[model samples]
Target: MRTVVYLVIGVFFGIVLFKSEAASWFRIYEMFQFGSFHMYGIIGSAVGLGIVIVQFIKRYKVRSFFGDKIVILSKEKSFYRYMIGGIIFGLGWALAGACPGPMFVLLGAGYLPIVIVIIASILGTFLYGLFRDKLPH
Candidate 1:
């Protein structure tokens, strides 16, 4: 089933995250403080890989698991929207000591305290869904 496939993929991804220290609070702290380049290197490599993957998808006309055509749409450019959103995201990351991507991984890796961050993330998402239409696009 697709659920099994997704679970396997998630396990592999979580192992990668743990091994790469992407889920480490210390690594995140270093990134925020500019104390080291380890996290930056990982993040930069991921970004570079993403660019290549996107190009490949576009060139080959990749399809989704459900067989739908994959579309990469560009959003309207907005400086202030990105600036404010980035500030809020950065503040949350700095405060919670982890990026949104690794919160669940942290919890799975025996970090019981990350439940708060996970809950807060879910709540924030719910709030966004409730207010997305009212907020600036």
Candidate 2:
């Protein structure tokens, strides 16, 4: 089943996150504190790979599993808007000790305290959705 495949893939991704220490709060703290390059290396590698993958997809006209055309949207060039968003995201990451993606991974890896982060993240998302239409584009 497609659901089973997705589940297995997610579990494998979580294992990778755990093995790479990307889900470690200490690693995240080190990143925020300039204590280590471990997390940065991981993130940089991911971003680099993402660039390559997107290029490949665009060149080859890749599609989703169900065959929808893949499209990479152009980023907005508003510097102040992006700066404000990044600052908000960075502050949350610092306070929570992990970003949104790793919150689920950390929770799955037996860090029960991540539940609070997960809940807050969900609430934040809900509030964002509620105000999305009213916010500036």
Question: Which one wins on TM-score?
Answer: 1
lDDT tens per residue, model 2, 1-137? 77997899898988998899998889999998899999999999999999999999989999988687999988869777688779988999999988987888988878899899899989988998898788775
Q: How many residue pairs clash in all the candidates, one count each?
A: 0, 0
For candidate 1, the per-residue lDDT at 34 reads 98
Q: Could you tell me the TM-score of candidate 2?
A: 0.90
Candidates' C-alpha lDDT: 0.91, 0.89
lDDT of 1 by residue, 1-137 (tens): 88998899998998899999999989999898899999999989999999999999999999988798999988889898899889989999999998887997898899999999999989998998998889886
Highest lDDT among the candidates is held by which one? 1
lDDT of 1 at 134: 91
Residue 85 of model 1, lDDT score: 88
In order of appearance, the predictions have TM-scores of 0.92, 0.90
